[model samples]
Target chain A: MAVKLFYEALHDGLEEEMQRNKDVLVIGEDVGHYGGSYKVTKGLHEQFGDLRVLDTPICENSFTGMAIGAAMVGLRPVIEGMNMGFLLLAFNQIANNAGMLRYTSGGQFKIPIVIRGPGGVGRQLGAEHSQRLEGYFNNVPGLKIVHTSTVYNAKGLLKSAIRDDNPVLFFEHVLLYNLKEEIPDEEYYVPLDKADVVRSGKDITILTYGRMRYHCLDAVKTLVANDIDPEVIDLISLKPLDMETIVASVKKTHRVIIVEEDMKSGGIGAEVAASIIEQCFDYLDAPVIRLAGKDVPVPYNGRMEETVIPYPKDIVRAVEDMLALRV
Target chain B: MVQEQLAPTKYDPIDRQEALMLYRDIVLGRTFEDMCAQMYYRGKMFGFVHLYNGQEAVSTGFIKQLRPDDYVTSTYRDHVHALSKGVPPRAVMAELFGKATGCSKGRGGSMHLFSAEHNLLGGFAFIGEGIPIALGAAFAAKYRGTDQVSVCFFGDGTTNNGQFFECLNMAVLWKLPILFVVENNLWSIGMQHHRASSVTDIYRKADAFDMPGYLVDGMDTLECRQAAIKAIKRARAGEGPTLLECSTYRFRGHSLADPDELRDPKEKEFWRKQDPIPKLTKFIQEQGLASAAELKLIEQEIRAEVEDAVQFGEDSPEPPVDELYRFQFAEDE
Candidate 1:
């Protein structure tokens, strides 16, 4: 195993996928000479040449639509959004074309394309740059939503996303790029539809993914000191959500707290909470609670950005409050 | 003399066999669309069914020249383009009928015809959205080091769409093998071209991308064919994309729902006189390319062929309800 940063893992995944399949390619703004805004595609241009590592103009809709077309013609194009937030401009292309093209084309085309980039609140990227787009793209059909938190899973999940025949929206948390972990030297793949049970406990299940998973784990430390053992489950796949793991956790713990950086209204947490209630209503000892991002736009101020999204303290309070009901 | 040389059949732009093939497709398009009008009126087809009536020349002129493998992306008014690109009329008709045997398996109705085998990308209902897709196909051709070209067809109104300009700029920048065939049918549904766009001259927009652009007589099949053939040659030779604005007109309303009173009767009469089908026939007779008897025989054959397509559509089964979720995700074959 070799130690690597989160962004390096993603880069390795892309490089390895491209190396394995000549048909796999990279396209986005500044991905060629500039090495990508986040450097996730660094050195790919030199290794794969300009055609394979394409640098497109700042036409998100056009490039995204074009990538969908290339995927239709049998090329596996992994389009990186310079910032995942900026790709909202191509939301129509993603929804109507990339997501629906396979179905709309009557199974004639398999849109084996990956749309991945950095997202979530980060150092106050303002409202536009800082966004949790998982909420926006979650409802789009024929798409798999992956949120990678660690270095190991980032590489494996990203490689899996690249190979997935369906269009995948891989959301990388901007804050977690520096986080490091040891990944196996040999090839590995994490299934797109599975959840990772980070920590096991008999108490409430703290369901979270992406950057929020770390926040929840941090809260788990305080919970552990307080003699409250909480199960932590990282929801890796946001769409085609890992319901089996969630159901098992819910059945075991009988209580749930969903933490996410996206908004409270119509958020992924809301969907997960509703689904848990639907599936395991009888098993639950207490009502499920959600700690999600505010409804308002992510503010530019660092302190204000922290207020909008969940903090470790929020998760701790949620765990304490839910456990207090049983007491 | 220059005008005479540019006219159809005057100098035999195509040989006898090619002429017959081109004429057959044009006839097929015209007949198929006429049947569509009948089907729509009879309540056999639903939704916005845009028929390509007067613009048969534009579809035939460009797509008839393409190899079966060459990609073609069309607008909502796309039945003819699909037919010209070699999508069987029966399948096109079946799609309109929303049948299982349709090109898109009845998942896509009239406006969204798709045939992967024919390389007909799809008929996008949204203006200019189809351009980028066609650009991708061209990009794939170039990336794969093939001489294959991608042809995108849309209307005059779609020129104002952001995707149109975005795709044009990128196509030139990437030096992709693509042909942007704008069928200037003089209107965008109810909006007249001059009123909708700042540049009334649509082909001039191509100059913004530094790509070669041609303005062709869309009603004249020979002129449209010549411009398209030259553009295809440039694309296949790796000379990059070219834009051709074919000034055609749609004889029918934008959709079946539109009342036929938006345009001036005088202007309608003028375009009616320039109807491409009759023009081709007259040219053929004048140049002795085919005699009247031969032309009549071809028309009769196309008429029967169109009737057969309608029968196929009528006889085809509706998509099974149990398999409603089948095509959502592709399974391992």
Candidate 2:
């Protein structure tokens, strides 16, 4: 086993997939010689040449659509979104073309395409640059959404996303790129649409994924010190959501706290909370609580930005509040 | 000087077999579209029906130049384009009827028709969506070191879409083998092309991409075929993409729903005088390429073919309820 950074694992996954299939290619702005804005694709162009590792202009709409077209044919194109915020420019292509191509074509075509990029608030990147737009794509059918919280899952999940016959939206937390984790050297693939329960506990269930998984884990440690054992669930697949695991956890824990880095209103946490209530409402000791980013654009000021998104303290507080509620 | 330049050029000499084939294709398209309109009006077809009535020459002319493996993408006004690309008339008609045997398995109605066998990539409903797709198809062909060229057929309104310019820039930059055919029918729904665009001449926009551009009389099949042949040849030679703007007009409303009150009667009359079906027929007879009786017999055969397609569509079964969930994802193991 070798320890790798989250971004390095991503690069390794892409490199291995490309090596395995000649039809696999990477296309996006600065993905070739520039090695991507995040450098996750560093040296891929040199290794695979220009045809496999393409650098496109700043036309997300056309390039995204082009990747869809390429996917319809024999190629499996992985389009880099630069940042999840930039995906808004190609929203039509992703939602209209990629999401609907297989159904619209009567299953005649398979779009084995992945649109991967860093998302969620990072550093002091202002409103437009920092966004966790998973909610926007989660509502769209015919799309599989994957957000990895660890370097190990990043590599394994990304490999699966690259191989999936359906269009996949892989969102990586910008802050987690350098986070290190031990990954097995042997070939392995993480199955899509399955949730991984990272921590086992009995009192309260903490549901989170992406960057917030780390925050929830941090909060779990504090909760443990305070004599509260919270089960932490990492929701890797956002779309074909692993609600079965969540419901079973809710049945066991009775109380739940959901954490997300996106805006609180219409957030993915709201969907998870709703699903929990609908599935195991009678088993719940208290109402499910959500700790998400404040309903506002991520501000430029470091202090304000830090306050806008959820922190470990917020998760701990939400769990405390949920547990304290009398039912 | 402008008047002298605008004067009609001498017609290119076409042999009897080629002339008859071209005439038959145009007549078939015209006949097929007319049947579609009649069926749509009689309530045999549902949803938005956009007829390619007066634009037969553009599709027939351009598609004739493409090899069987060459890809073609088109806009919502795609019935004639699909026909020209070799999608069976029965399948196209069945698609309009939303039958399971249709090209898109009844999932896509009027606006979306696709056939992998014929390499008719799709008929995209969004105005300029097909442009980038065609570019990608060309990119795939070039990447595989194949000489297959892709053709994208869109209306004048599509030129204004950001994807159109973006695709042009990339197509030229990558030297992709693509031919963008702009069917400038002058109306995007009720909006006129000149009113929506900064420059009225759409072909000239190709110069911005550093690619060759040509404006052809879309009412003339011969002119369109010649221009398309040149563009296709250049693309096959790896000279990169070419933009061909075919100046044509739609005889029908934007869709069956429109009243078509936006166009001037005088302008309509002028274009009616240039109707390509009769124009080709006149040329065929004037050159003694095909006898009047022979042309009439061909027209009769086309009418029978169209009637047979209608029967096929009507006889086809509706998709079962369980089939509704299928085809959302590929069944590949």
Candidate 3:
């Protein structure tokens, strides 16, 4: 076992993949020479050379399209966007091009590509830099969306994402990178599209991912102290959601609470909640509840932004409200 | 001083069979566009339909010269490109009909036609986006040591995009086996090329990228074929990429919805007078490639083919409502 931070795990995973496969290359702005924006790709360019670790011009759409093209031509490209917020500029290529190529080609082509970057609010990075776009991407089809909340899962899931014959949008929360966990030393992979039962219980189901996964875990502890056993499901992959696990858990508990760091309206939580009601309506004891960020621009202030986004206390309060409704 | 190795090929004597195939492709492309125009008017299709009514020679001439196993990538004005690559007209019509039998299972309409069998990468809707993709395909061809070349087709407007220059630089620098074909029609949407571009001559733009460039009369099918054959041969032989500027015109507006009044009435009449079909028909007749009766029979055959395609599209089933969420993953779990 190895104790490593989430960022370190990502670095190790990328290094291992690059060494393992000559076709695996990393390209992005400031990823080469200057290291990564967060120094995650530090010393990569020197080891791998400029051909593999590329420094692209500030054209996000071009680089994104180039990455797709590279992937189409039998290269596994790990494209890094400086921040997830910048992914908006490349949305056309990601949504229209990368997302459609595999199916449009009738499975003759596969884009084994990984587009990764930091997501969610961190300090006072303001509106553009700190926005959570998981929900925006969740609306797009033909993409596997993954959010790594733990160091172990980050390495395991990223390795799987690189090896998978699909385009994956790997969301690394800016706040969770420094957080540490013990990861196995041996090579392993955690399959995408399946949710992890982070903390299991029976009284209620708390579905969440990314930084909010930890927050939900904290909330579950509080709920336990108040004599409630809240089951926490970490949704690693958001698009091809393991509806089986969600519906099965919902059927057992009969109550659901979704926590997301993104806005309440049109959030991924809304989709999951809607899916639960549509697929397992008869099994529900109560309406599926969602504890998401308030529908507003993310604030720049540290404390105000923290309050606006979903917190452990928010999840606990929502669970308490749901329990009262059941009574 | 011109380098002998980089010079354009002299005109060659083409066989009668090759002549008929070229003529057939031009007619097929025109018929496909004509059907798309009528379908859009009848509300049988939705979204932007960029008809290639007056630009048949460019798609026909270029694609006919390439091997079926070679690849092609292009922009939104691509119903003709799809037809030229031998995508079933019925399948294209079904796509326009948004039916399950369509090329992309009705997920992608008019601008996004993709035929993997013929190595037609896709008709990417975004301008200049397909160039690098084509280059990458060509790169793969080179890497695998295949006798395949990838041709990228785009309109005059795409030259103004940043990716155009970037792709040109990379494709030329790396000696990627690709051909960049510019269907330089006078207008892009509503703006004239002269008004939109810093330098209106597209071939000169190719020169700046350190690659050989050629200017062809896009209205003349023979001229287009002559230029394209050389460029395609160059790319396939690993001689590096070439840029061909096919100066063409579009008889219709950019899309079915575009009420184009931007151009002079005289300019529109001038290009329409040089319609590719009539030009090719004259060549075929002047050279005695086919008799007048044979030409009439060909026209009848094409009309019948087009009508059958439209019927196939109309009779095809619409994509099931549940399939709206289909293809989200490779397999539905």
Candidate 4:
């Protein structure tokens, strides 16, 4: 196993996929000679040349739509959003063209494309720059959303996204770029619709994904010290929600707490909580609580933004409050 | 240097064989669409049946100039374009009827049409959506070193869209082989082109992107053909993309649902006089391309084909209810 940063693992995964398939192309603004805005695509343009690594103008909607067209005729295009927030301009193409084209076209055109970039509650990043579009796009059908929380899974999940026959939206947290972990030397791919059981415990099922997964771990340290052993499950797949894994975990723990960076209104936690109630209603010892960000535009101020986003302490408090409930 | 081809005139250069083929295709489109109007009124087809009544010349003129392997994308008014691209009339009719035998397997009605074999990408209902998709097909052609030129067909309303400018810029920057054909029929539903656009001259907008733009006589098939031939030649030779503004008009309202009353009756009367079908028929006869009897025979044959297509649609079954969830994901063949 070799230690790799989260961004470096993502780069390695994209490079390997491109090398394995000549049809795979990397296209976005600053993705070519500039080496991508996040430096995740560094050294790729030099290796693949302009044909495979293309630098598109900042027309997000058209370029994304163009990539979908290319995918139809036998090309796998990976579109890197300079920032995921900027992709709101491309929501039309992503939803109307990419998301619904195959089904509306009667499956004649198979869109094998991956739209990936870094976006989440950032460290002092402006409201415009910091966006959790995963929630915005989760309601859209025909899209597979995968958010990678660690270095090992970032590489594995990305390769799987590139090879998917349908459109896959790969969400990477901006603040977790430097997180490092050792990964196997051989090429490996993680399933796009599975959750990672980070830690096993009998007390409760702590559900989280992306950046919040690490924050949940921070709270877990205190919980373990206080004799509260909460089971942790990282939901890598945001769209399908991995009902098999989530339901089983809920059945065992009988208590659920969801922590996420997305806003509270119409967020991933709401969907998960609803699914749990619908599927595992009798297994619960307490009502499922969600420690999601406040439903508002993210603030740029360090302290103000922290107020909206849930930290490790908030998760610890929520678990303690839930534990005190006898019903 | 001496001018090799004559300037735009009543009739441009076209051989007898090519002229007959164009006449036949135009007739098929007009006849098929007229049948669609009948079916739409009688409730055989549903949901925004946009008839390509007077736009036959544009579809035939441009598509007839392309190789079968080349790709084409169209807007909601797409049945004529699909027919010109060699999608079978029966299959297209079945699709409009929402039957399983449709080219899109009954999933896509009038607003969406697709055929992988013929490479008709789709019929996008939303304006300005399919241009970038066509640009991608052209990009793939350049990436694979194929001489295939991708063509996108949209109405004058689509010209006002941001995607129009965006795609034109990329097509020039990447030097992709594509043709942005705007069938400027002068109205986007009830919105008049003059009222909606700052520059009603859509072809002139191509100057912003530094690509060649032409204002062609869309009511004349030979003239439209001459313009298409040049653009296709430039694209095939890897020069770059071209924008062609074909000044045409739709004889019917925007869709069957729309009442034919928005435009000044005078405007409709004037365009009706310049209808592409009669113009082509006169040019072919006067130029000694085809005799009156021969043209009549061709029209008769196309009518039978269109009638048989209606029967095929009527006989075809609706997609099974049990498989409603099918085609949403990629299923292994």
Q: What TM-score, over all chains together, does every model reach?
A: 0.98, 0.97, 0.85, 0.98
lDDT of 3 by residue, A57-162 (tens): 6767767887787677687889899998998988888987788877665454678889999988888888898888988888777898998888888998999999
Output the lDDT of residue B128, model 4: 95
Q: Which of the CAPRI classes, incorrect, acceptable, medium or high, describes model 1? A: medium
Whose lDDT is greatest here?
4
For residues B130-220, could you state the per-residue lDDT of candidate 1 as single tens digits? Answer: 9999999999999999999999999999899889999999999988999999999888878999999999887788888888877889998
lDDT of 2 by residue, B83-161 (tens): 9988989999999999998999898888999988888889999989988888889999988899999999999998999
| Residue lDDT tens for model 2, A1-327 | 999888899999999999999999999989999999888999999999998999999999999999888788778999998988898999988998888878877888888999999999999988988997988888876898988889899999999999999999999988889998888999889988899999999999988888888888899889999999899999999987798999999889998888888788888988898888788899998877888888988889999889987899888888888877744
Error of 4 at B254 (Å): 0.9
TM-score of candidate 4 on Cα atoms, chains taken together: 0.98
Kindly report which residue stretches of model 4 are placed more than 4 angstroms away from their true locations once superposed: B1-6, B10-13
Give the winner by DockQ: 3 or 4: 4
CA-based DockQ, model 3: 0.31
Interface DockQ per candidate:
0.78, 0.67, 0.31, 0.78
How well is each residue in A1-327 modelled by candidate 1, as lDDT tens digits? 889998899999999999999999999999999998888988989989999999999999999999999999999999999999889999888998888877877889888999999999899679998898998999998888999989999999999999999899999989898998888999999998899999999998999999999899899999999999999999999998889999999999999999999889998999999999888899999988999999999888887777998999999998899989996
Where is model 1 chain A poorest over a 10-residue stretch in terms of lDDT? A98-107
Off by over 4 Å in 1: B1-12
Full-model lDDT for every candidate:
0.90, 0.89, 0.84, 0.92
